[model samples]
Target: MVDADQTFVIVGGGLAGAKAAETLRAEGFTGRVILISDERDHPYERPPLSKGYLLGKEERDSVFVHEPAWYAQNDIELHLGQFVDRIDRAAKTVRYGDDGTLVRYDKLLLVTGAEPRRLDIPGTGLAGVHHLRRLAHAERLKGVLTALGRDNGHLVIAGAGWIGLEVAAAAREYGAEVTVIDPEPTPLHHVLGPELGGVFAELHREHGVRFRFGRRLTEIVGQDGMVLAVRTDDGEEHPAHDVLAAIGAAPRTGLAEAAGLEIADRAHGGGIVVDERLRTCDPDIYAAGDVANFPLALFGTELRVEHWANALNGGPAAARSMLGQDVTYDRIPYFFTDQYDLGMEYSGWAPPGSYDQVVIRGDAGKREFIAFWLSQGRVLAGMNVNVWDVTEGIQKLIRTRTQVDPEALANPHVPLDTLTS
Candidate 1:
């Protein structure tokens, strides 16, 4: 039975952890709640880190999930800048901080999140090299972009993924020169495939963002502890005042791994494996957000989504399940991106090789269109670029698993709701 004596401990101070704590209180759990985070800042959302905040359009204080007073007001024990290195599953305790402070909990939630993948090449420690994952990184880069823009300096980005492209757009808007280098033939190749990926490449190119595709960063050349340029595998040196590594992020699962919890492999997105209830192998331990690989009944697959939407909803779902409430985490995989003038929202899973054909509605050249990824006449995923308020219909199409007619799906006149039926 739920009681006030029980304690719940949450690790990681991101959106998921904060939302989980909020849900616990809303569900009438009068237990002791402790939230530990290595970051000194309060729990915050990450979308702004790469988008509005980086563009200098949003204030720094706006990134925080809740006001500083919210935690204490809610009676949550907020421990900032504390490193939790060990989880003693047998004793239901976790050792944190250099002083080895121990916190006992009846239930533990791991929302440790992910860290940005570092550049393997040399000169990564140079002053001009940057990686964006935290609020601090964004702050540092914001200043760097402003200075680079004023000086008409050049920024070379390694990786053409979401982070790389978003940063590229931000830099361009700041009037700084940008050149994105990636080994893939086109940007976002892994996620959108060549067909739609080309659209992004074209979009970036039109915005004065240079693309050096089919190449990898061999080394970051620097002088006097500051980046000078980057050399690609083709022996071409690109002059760069700054270098941004936007490669990717790996889930933070060291604590979970040390606790002997089941972790998903790379194929499954390399995260702590959780059931539909968001419970790990241990009955008392649950995980959510970017660090969790949970089953998606709608897709018949387990996925670790590193998007804001996943963390936003997954936290509350895990909290309910932890409170012994019925929970099934089957939300459709959803993500959106803003690049230059293009704003895109994607729903469902349609990684390369999963979809047979891509059908488009509206005008691609006009930068207003919706692309549907289909497999055996079934809509696997749908992305609306510059299109608004159709997420519900798109998700319904995916949820119903309807075999949409390609012609009707591509016709702008045909409504999406009719396709689901």
Candidate 2:
């Protein structure tokens, strides 16, 4: 065990950083742990912001990972509303922007997470144009939706990824005319294969959501500093009272890069590279969560996942590695999305063009089914639509790498557990 007086400085107070601190304590590390976060509030769960929280189904307090008392009880110092300016590796200290204070650390964990990718266009700075990344964004959106009731208000979402889709569903449920525009052909095509992506696109379309796929948003039009309409690249104008830019996120790697750490490009977009143990080239500093592009054991590729599950799992893994415990961060990747009463779950890894066959279990038309991506007669990945049990079963199969007959997999009469044997 490390000395109790040793100091550990963790940057960012998001899920990964918070969980790492908690895990450190749980593992008998009674050290001086300080969690520095730029946000004013304590670390809170961000997943619900685009779904239940935005729709007024979940409260702000309920979405928080821990209350103020929990941090105090854990003996973790919470430095809220403080920005980390730079990391001096030679001095082993972090400089803060608030007071120009420098704090030394024996070990540091970089869980800086990510920020929303902004568009460089006119009227993007307008009042009604927003991006859903923080609690403030969700609160602002809720306020706008409340003032402009669904029947009269129109919401135009600039991206068709998970966040945009969830927000579109929430806006539709609130009685607003919603439109989703994306440059990609289908929503979730980058993660889910084209077949499943088509089904997801169809599902959203059937629920009163208008989709303008394969179109780029050129500019936003504003009147008196508030959004009035958005223009597409094809010169089509959408008269939207509110606009949401959900074009995914970019890694918060400025501090790490400035510290001379080795960073690499992500497969989908902007992220930093990390090894299997979530360690950067600078052995003293480690990174995880959304900012990291770590190697996947299942896919044999380095991928970055911006999901709550990844943050929660990867944080502790990186923390353990930081504590001199050589643990391999090789768990099967899993993520879930809740949209308008629909629960979607995905597990395992499926790289692009890796799957040779796909087996559909249950009925997609019924809004409940599991799609399994098979490579070499083994399940590589599985996507569950409102079917949790099937997802749990597929997770096991993926971990075990069990071989199963394709015909039995498609048959609803057969139990999912039978495929494992």
Candidate 3:
């Protein structure tokens, strides 16, 4: 039975918030769970925004992390389409939308996620110009993609990050003429490095996708308030019936910052700083998911991971920590992406450009391989591309930090266990 007087308020109705509520109830916490979300939809998984959902492979309901009735059945109160104006730490209250009443809470969870970084270029707000971070954005983009059949629908995509490439792949499948524009000579070079990034670039190229690399969009040319084309820095203009900017996202930390929570500086990913337990400077408040730049005890570093796994796993950990359970959010960070026929899963965290070399155990030409990032003969991180049932082995190598010969590690005949040993 839930306690009548105690209340636990969760801000942001994303994956972390929904999971936090579920965990609180499953853990037998008899306190009120009030989930507040500015978006009207039920808390949903966001990965589908670029892939499954955008491609129409997933239904609208399937994108939701929880069913509509789950909250009511579990006795979790929901405040959908409502924004939180402010958080008063000293008063232990959350002020509702401007002029709304305060909702008192014994404990608070800041699970607010990130938002797409928008372009400041001219005509960005015009029709047919899109930036995706929400379900509504993806839904609107569906029409533009379908327009490919009506006429020549040319899509000009800005940025070549994970989301950018995935969206490009999905758009191409829909028969749109996709062109990816980015300042980087190679897509994903910042994350995967040049060698692997080149492979991905080749993968997309073989599939008929065009790339305008080493270019930046200076303006979005428009006609009668609708986007027509994008002008590059070098005075080159590309025709665009629709434009999608997948530049990146920034952590939504306005509420946390307003309440005087400690936020990490740019060097540490610029998110709400929390300890290993996901507890903020104030014991009464905890943060998780994309907004929380918590310490990684295993790697001796801090990360603000905006991936599904971190949000899915960190929610329960934050809930347990809130219930005073001896907990540590110290799992090795992991993330995955899909483009064309290539699917990749990566585990472990190394500082920016920290790995000295990468060892490959499978054929890159065939796109079936496990690539390990090694520093001083020890595995620091690894990724498996189009390889099956090897994530466990890859993660173990990262967790154990085992030193292995580069030659053995690169040899496919050598069993993964033997190389680690």
Q: TM-scores of the models, in the given order?
A: 0.99, 0.96, 0.97
Better of 1 and 2 by TM-score: 1
* C-alpha lDDT score of every prediction, in listed order: 0.95, 0.86, 0.88
Local accuracy of candidate 3 as per-residue lDDT tens digits, 13-39? 999999999999999997789999999
Leading candidate by lDDT: 1
Q: What TM-score does model 2 achieve against the real structure?
A: 0.96
Please identify model 1 stretches exceeding 4 Å from their true place.
none
Model 1 alpha-carbon miss at residue 355, Å: 0.8
What RMSD does each model have against the real structure? 0.7, 1.6, 1.7
The whole-model C-alpha lDDT of candidate 2 against the native structure comes to 0.86
Q: Write the per-residue lDDT of candidate 2 for residues 1-421, one digit (tens) a residue.
A: 5788789889998999999998898888988999999999899888889878899988889878888899989899999999999999999999996689999998889999999999888888898888899998899988877766634788899888899998888887777888899888888877776778888788788888899998999999989988899999999999899898998899999999999887776544456677888888877788889988888766667778888998999889988888889888887888888887789889987755988998898898887888889999999998888886666788888988888899998888998888887
Candidate 2: misplaced stretches above 4 Å? Answer: none
